[model samples]
Target chain A: MAKALLLNPTAFEAGLVAAARARALSPAQSAALEAFSKTGLPHRRIEAWKWTDIRANLRDDLSSASAANDVIAPSIFGGLGAFEITIMNGAAEWSGEAPAGVTISCTPQGGPLSELASNHPLANLAFLNTDETIAINVAEGASVEKPLLIRRIAGGGAIHQRVTVKVGACSKVTIIESFDGVGRYFSNSVTEFSIESGASVERLVLQNGSDDGVETALCAVAAETMSKFHQTALLLGARIVRIESRIALGGEDAQADLRSASMLCGMRHADVTSQIDHRAKGCTTRQLHKSALKDKADGVFQGKFLVARGAQKTDARMSVNALLLSDFAEARHKPELEIYADDVECAHGSTVGALDDAALFYIKSRGLDDAAARALLTEAFLGEAFDAMPHPAIERTFRTRIARWLEAGK
Target chain B: MLKIEDLHVAVGGHEILKGLSLEVPAGEVHAVMGPNGSGKSTLSFTLAGREDYEVTAGDVTLEGENLLQLAANERAAKGVFLSFQNPMEIPGVATMNFIRTALNAQRKTRGEEEVSAADFLKLIREKGKLVGLSDEKLKRPFNVGFSGGEKKRMEMLQLALFQPRFVIMDETDSGLDIDALKMVGEVVNSLRAPDRGFLVITHYQRLLDYIKPDRVHILAAGRIVKSGGPELAAELEKSGYDQFIKAA
Candidate 1:
């Protein structure tokens, strides 16, 4: 019994092993399962997940069965008129026509895990359990007029999904992925994006989970020469949620922009972490994160930029700020830069504090009650991160989400 | 219209207003002249219902309503406005939207109908021009990157917009030029009403030259040392608060 417990420390892990044994697994899936066995689940003991202890939060046997099929809410971004792809309960489904110069397909077997996911436990778990892999490809030198919407909705139990997007050379496409779920469940997903030379991809994510759900999404991006990748995410935390991104600028003159905001209340938690690797010269990256926490909610942000020895003249800056509305609310931020090249310009800043007393008084003196004043200030604080989004309708949708959160807080 | 009886206020455990008492009747503007550290701004903040200004012993009433029992915003709904000596630079808050929200909030609390957006835009544009603020300046974030005079202009603009029952101007003329001072006087003169009252707290007599006050009081050592007609302002301006400080 002791040896068996050591092999599978958690009931969730035991369920995963049982499910894998019931099916014929590919070598990659077998390797991923083997890697996941080394560490049952990331906890406080791990340096990378000190503030977000996943093992401590999960208790039940999450791998028992998939979530119950329910009517999914319409996408908040339905007005964008994008080609819609819905993935529910680890199953991929779509019926719309693909956009011009774009091809969408799904395969029963997922591809091998990339280097970023090779060592990530959660990403490995998602890869090993995914039922199908969805692929979106845009042809070279093609500009897709409409956007691409990937709506991932989940409910109950455990669910894992995977998606890969490839933008051909000089192509442009906008992708919006929204994560929504209901009831108690564990939703783990892994998404990969490959941007070729001179290609551009704008990705927007909106994650709002149920009060009892646990979600973890890992995105890996590889950008070639002159490629551009921009991503913005708004996360309203759940029981426990983590959104992590790893981007590698592999060619000269590549650029990436990452921005995210999280507003959490009650006992919910949210973590937004990113690691950007500058491997080539003249690459630029900018990242900003904002969070507003109230009650006993927790917010975490960990960002690191690594400039290699050959990646001279690299430019990168990161700013992380959090506002604690209640005395019990907590925020933890870790920003670091490791540069082997002396000519690179990289900097990061973090600040965590309550609302300004004078500003609150000023707003109140103008006739807003305490709650209204706080909500207004909090909205303004988080609104700055969404100002640079290119799509007006998409921007309004994010703003509307923020307003709803504020209303609930009030 | 406003009355403070034996008000004793403390800040950070130190008494700032010691047994101070004063009154300003309706349909009149009263000027309170004082040197630095004379509790003029403390009185303004206490009247505006700032949380930091603790009223250890006092009775403040506006139109016979107990102002001490209400919060800052409640007092605002009751028509209490303070033009901050140093107007805050609140970034990311649009100027017009914020003012409109405040206006609607006040109107809602008073059981009055809210002003529509188009009507508010027109009103603000008309009043913004009255306070020498252009349409372009009114479109920017609240007080962001504004010059000192422009911030004062914003204060005046709000003063004109709210048109509160009781107004407290704390050093509203400290950083203004001649033209801006004239603008301030014009806005105040336009808002003066028979049922409304004003308390202009200042260090100099230049602001009084524009909007003539009905009475002037000398504040020293957290109490009113002298009270007289508007001529008292000119007298104190020349003689200064040295004698009054010594008497206290």
Candidate 2:
């Protein structure tokens, strides 16, 4: 077996290979496992995983336990009147009336891996371990009145899951994917979104994890002509977490808006990374990321926009700003732009610094105490990304989460 | 309503206010005229309870309460307002919302009832118009993209809204036009009452033309060198601060 042939592997890697060998693997799963075995697990040595070293995090052998039967709490989005689908550990379950014009199904295994999934090591790991892939399909020319919520809950084990969303032409849908968990566990998830021509998808990912949890979620998106993909992610770090996205604007005149905020405190860490590929003409992309770190926490953001040779008139701009609240807190950012088209406009910027003392003193002099002033300033710094949320309730929900983090810090 | 006794302030271990004593009785407007680096701003900041300005010695009291024992926000709650010389441009902080929050926070700290949102909106719009700021400008972030005159006008707007007991205008007229200076005088004159006091710090007498002062003091070399009537401002403006600098 490849497990024995592989050179000195870590305990976690060996445990993963042993678990795969014990199961009746499908052909696709075996292919993914073989591909994953070549690189073992992403670590500091890998250029992409330099800031987030997964191998170093999972040094000990972790058993592949079944999903814990913990009592599931109501999701924070329960008031949105949306259709809910729950994924506990690696298992998927849903019992409710699906949203109008939306059909859901499950397959024993997903189809061949996409270009992005094939290259990402964490995505391959998830694909190999997940037995059922939940697929949500929106009908053509349908405007769904309700949102679709995917609640992922994990507990006590190494769990992996896969989900795919397909939006038909001229349809509109909002999807909220939330990650919540308890106790010690490792969660690796891969999600794919295929938006047809003229379709619109608003994706919101909220992750709040336990202190002992390690999670990696990678989402790949393929946007067609005139399609719109707007995504916002709020990542509250766990022991170690990385949420990444790979977007390909393959059709002309497509647009994408990606914004993310990470508020990490204590000893936790979070990394938000994305790579947007502009392969069509006249496509526009705007990306912004903000992070506020406190205590001894660490935050990282890595973003790149690539405009292809034929992607003329592509307009893309990316900005990242981090506010460090402590002397020991750290923020690392890398924003890059690679353009081969002469007519394209692409730019990127990054900044990392502490909160403005003048602003804080101004606020304090206006009547807010020290803690209240700090909280107000920090919220304003991170609240800019969520200013454009179409739904006021959702925006308030995100702001409430930020407030809770600030409160906890105080 | 405000009194300072032998106040000594140091910034970065360098004394700026050396035994500077002053007093502003209730319903009176006092002007402190000084050249650059003459401890004018240091006095305002020290009285406002700024952390960095070390008070090596002295006492400051507002309404017979020991103001030096409180924090900046607490001092604010105690009705001490220092209109900053250079207002900060705080991005992402809505101007109206922040002013309302500050008003409510001060009220709450003083064990008073908070204002309703509707009432706050109405009050801000009224004051914003008085300060020559449109509703669009008030909707933007606090002082963001605002001109120097507009920022000072916003400060006047706050002054009108808060109506604190003690007011310290630290170089409030440095960047204002004649019209804005008139607006500042109007706001201060309108807020004047039997229990309120004003300390207007300025370099020129132009702003004094609109809001006449009961007394004017020339500050130089970290101390008050001379005192006179409002005519002192006109006199110093004509002769400049050269004589006072030499005398110090």
Residue A29, model 1: Cα distance from true site in angstroms: 1.7
lDDT by residue (tens digit), candidate 2, A119-181: 898888888887888988999998997889999998768989999989999999999999987
Q: What are the RMSDs of all candidates, in order? A: 1.9, 1.7
Q: Worst lDDT window (10 residues) for model 2 chain B?
A: B43-52
Q: What is the lDDT of candidate 1?
A: 0.90
User: Tens-digit lDDT track for model 1 on A267-332?
Assistant: 999999999999999999999999999999999999999999999999999999999999999999
- Indicate the DockQ of the complex predicted as candidate 2: 0.82
In model 2, the Cα lDDT at residue B225 comes to 92
**What class would a CAPRI assessor give candidate 1's docking?**
high
Worst 10 residues of 1 chain A by lDDT: A1-10
Evaluate candidate 2 by giving its C-alpha RMSD to the native, one decimal: 1.7
